[model samples]
Target: MATLHHSSFCPHSRFVRLIMAEMGMEPHLVEERPWERREEFLMMNPAGTTPVLVEEGGLAVPGASIIAEYLDETRGLGLSGLRLLPESPAARVEVRRLLDWFLQKFDQEVTGYLVTEKIHKRFMTSQHGGGPPDMNAIRAARSNVRYHLKYIGYLISRRNWLAGSQLTYADLAAAAHLSCVDYLGDVPWDEDEMARNWYARVKSRPSFRSLLTDRVAGMAPADHYADLDF
Candidate 1:
């Protein structure tokens, strides 16, 4: 079995975890704190990011995107009808585009700010920027998330999933980030019923069970965070 270096609240980590679960690969999960910049972790990934995959041969694959591609190449593509990536070039581009939108753009604008301010800071020490949560950043993230939710609603209104007719890496990526924000009780699910419904479908999947049960030590999830019908 492979080992996964991850963090419960890190959207990128959560994204990779979801991918593995979907691919029917259960890895040994080791939660990590990227902010600590541990020497060993740095050796594995110079950037000290989470969601690094260490295979049986000691090969460490770093970053969510790289890990996703690596997993698909090594195993996921063999899943046939269950593959998270599409086979056609145009369809694959759509999946990749939405994947980037959620993991990069939505992250920078929403999930990153919310997690850094609410979750990451709590676990950090004073010297490592640990302190009271930044209300300003938190508030900004809350406001920005509504736009992304609206975008999700717009997309889902037209298609069965984020990228197209089938579930793809894009759906998992978006859900990973939304799940983190939802844990903080920040996602305004009521504002976009279509988005909420889309999320409900993803959240109800067997691959999402582990994530729904995730706990962050001192922090509790929102009331509806684990609700399948919500």
Candidate 2:
């Protein structure tokens, strides 16, 4: 079996986890603190990011995007209708576009700030820059989240999922990031009914079960974090 090095609140890590679950994979999960910058971990991924997948034969796949593509290439063909990536090149492009939107753009604008300030810092020591949460960054992320929720609402209003009618990696990527913010109670779900409904549908999936139960060590999630009907 493969082993995945991940962090509980990292959206990119969460994205890969959801992908693996949807693909019916059961890799061993190892929680990694990237800030700690362990020598062995760095050797696996010199960039020191989470969500590194180590195969049984000692192959290390680093980064969520790379890992997602690697898994799809390795296992997705067998899944047929259940494949998270589409068959058509154009369709695949759309999925990758949304993947970039959520994993990179959304992260830069939202989760990167919220998670770092609210979750990551709490786990780090002063030597690694841990301290009281940065309210300014948190406030900016909070404000930015509303816009993202509105965008999600806009996208879902016209289609069954973020990229299209199919449930692709796009949906998983978006849901993963939103789930992290939702855990922090930073998402303004009530402000976008369409987005909230879409999230509810995604949240209810069996693949989402583990994420719904994830907890931060010293901090509990938002009241509705694990509520399926919320």
Candidate 3:
């Protein structure tokens, strides 16, 4: 069995968790608070990121993308239409490009702000005693979210998923970030019916059930978050 070092609410960590569930592999879950800067955690991945995977031979894999590939390669979890990468050069490039979009774009526009405000406190404590989140930054993030939804809406209206016709890593990665936003009702579900319809299918997956159960301190998930049909 593989061991994964991660926290419960991190979007990146959640990415790895979703991949594990989708691939049907059970990994030992070890929580790591990124701010703690522990030597042991540092040793696993000097980059200091969560979602580190330690293999049987003790090769530590960092980043959700790498870990997902490792699992598919080692565990033979490759489902015909579900393998994230494509064999064709063009399609494979597109898949990787979309993956980067979600990891970087969505991270900057959505997860970065929300995590720092609502989710980070529970996992990342301030180096100083305790500090309140920056309301101004939160406001900017909230505003940025609207554009992202419009973009996703356009994608859903045109393509079957966030990528092209396939449900690649792009979908899972986007879903990972959106799950956090959705938990807080930050997603404007009524913004676009196509996007809402797309989300309805994504959120109904067995891989999504655990995320629906996630809770944040002092904030209840949006009432409709766990409702599969809603």
Candidate 4:
């Protein structure tokens, strides 16, 4: 069985989880804090990031995008339908573009804010290298949330999924980052019905169930957090 060492609040980890779910592959899970700097964990991933995958034969795989591609290639599930990556140049470009948007743009603008404010202190209360989170930064992120939501609304309004017609890794990436924000009650679901509807579908998936169960000390998630219908 493949083992995953990850934190529930991480969007990148969640992205890989969504991919395994889309492929109908489930792996055993283990929770670990990245900051502990454990010898084994650090050896497995010198970058010291979560979402490291231990393959069946025991090779530590780092990074969500890399792990997803590994799963796709090893499992023989080419990205055509739900997997999203395809042999065709057009399909590959389409999926790649969306993946970049979510992993880079969404993570930098949206997840960075909420994770630092709500989730980071839990794992990083001791590792205050960056000093306390800038409330101003969080405030800025909160303000930027509206723009992200509107952008998503536009995408969902035009395309069925964030990338291409089918539910691709891009949707999972967006949903993963959004989930972290949602956990902090920062997401304004009421901003767009279309966006809300899209999230509902992504939230209802079984892979997302684990993420919904996450809780940070003294930081209780909002009431609508686990509610699929809400």
Candidate 5:
């Protein structure tokens, strides 16, 4: 069996988890804090990032995009479940585009700021630069999320999923980031009905069940974190 090293509130880590579940790959889960920079974990991924997948054979795969592509290559796309990367080249390009959009753009503007301020800060010591959450950063992240939610609504209104008609990594990527923010009750779900409806569909998936139940050591999820109807 493979082992997945991940953080509870890391959106990228969560994205990889969702993909693994969707593909029916049951890897042993090891919750990690990348900030700690453990030597053993660093040996596996020199970059010291979470969501590293170490195969039973001792091959380690780092980063969400690499792992997702590696799984698609080794497991054979569309074999066990939905094809995360679309078959057609054009379609695949679109999927990758949206995947980057959420993982990079949205993350920098919203998820990254919020998580670092709200969750990571609590876990860090003053020696490591950890302290009280920055109210300004949190406020900016909150304002940024509303625009993202609206953008999601616009995308889903035209297509069944973010990238296209078929569910793909794009959806998983977006959902993963949104799930992290939603856990903190930062998402304005009520502001965009289309986006909320789209999320409701994604939230009900079997792959999403584990995330709903995920609880950080000292932080509680939002009241509706696990509610399918919400």
Candidate 6:
């Protein structure tokens, strides 16, 4: 079995987790806080990031993009579950584009700011220079998320999934970030019914069960986090 080192609220980590579940591969999970800068963890990933996947044979895959591609290349055999990446060159490019959109653009504009202020700051010690959450940053993130929700609604209105007719890495990537924000009660789901309806379908999947049940040590998810209907 492989071991996945990840943080509970890291959107990139969550992306990899969702992909693994959707692929029907269950790797052992090792909860890690990259800010702690553990020596052994650093040896595995010099980037000091969550979600370094280490295989039983000692092969280590760092970064969400690398891991997703690695899995798709190695385990994506035959007609099993939906392939995270599409077979056609053009479709694959679109999936990667949307994957980057959420991982980089959405993270930069919304999820990253919110999680850093709300979750990461809470875990940092005073010695590590931790302080109160930045209200201004939180407010900015909140405002930005509405635009993202609208974007999600717009995409789903035209296509079955974010990238196209198939459920690809694009959908998983978007959901991963949205799930983290939703956990903080920051997502304005009611403001966009289409986005909410699409999310409701993703939430009901067996692959999403583990994430929906994830509980941080001192923080509880919003009341509707695990509610399939909501």
Clashes of each: 0, 0, 0, 1, 0, 0
**Poorest lDDT segment (10 consecutive residues) of candidate 5:** 74-83
lDDT of 6 by residue, 39-133 (tens): 99999999998889999999999999899899989987643657779899999899998899999999998988889888888889977647899
**Model 2 alpha-carbon drift over 4 Å, by segment:** none
**lDDT, candidates in the order shown:** 0.93, 0.93, 0.80, 0.81, 0.91, 0.90
> What digit string (tens of lDDT, one per residue) describes model 3 on residues 86-171?
56778878777877888888898778888878767654545622367778878888888888888888888889888788777778
Which pairs of residues collide in candidate 3?
none
- Note the residue pairs that clash in candidate 6: none
lDDT of 2 by residue, 5-66 (tens): 99988999999999999998899999999999999999999999998999999999999999
lDDT of 1 by residue, 1-230 (tens): 89999999999999999999998889999989998999999999998989899999999999999998888888976899978988899998999999899989999999989999898998999999999988888888999999999999999999999999999999999999999999989999999999999999999999999999989888889999999987
Per-residue CA lDDT of model 4 for 1-230, tens digit only, reads 88988878888988888777777778898887776777899999999988899988999999988886787678736545455566668877877787887787777887877786667765565544334667887888888888888888898999988766777777888898898898888998888889999999999988788788878878799889999999
Model 6 TM-score, 2 decimals: 0.96
Write out the backbone clash pairs for model 2.
Answer: none
Looking at model 5, residue 12 earns an lDDT score of: 95
- Candidates 1 and 3 compared: the better one by TM-score is 1
TM-score of each: 0.98, 0.98, 0.92, 0.91, 0.97, 0.96
Candidate 5 lDDT, tens digit per residue, 112-211?
A: 9999999888899887769999999999999999999999999999999999998888999999999999999999989999999999999999999989
RMSD of each: 0.8, 0.8, 1.8, 2.1, 1.2, 1.2
Candidate 3, run of 10 with poorest lDDT = 121-130
Better of 4 and 5 by lDDT: 5
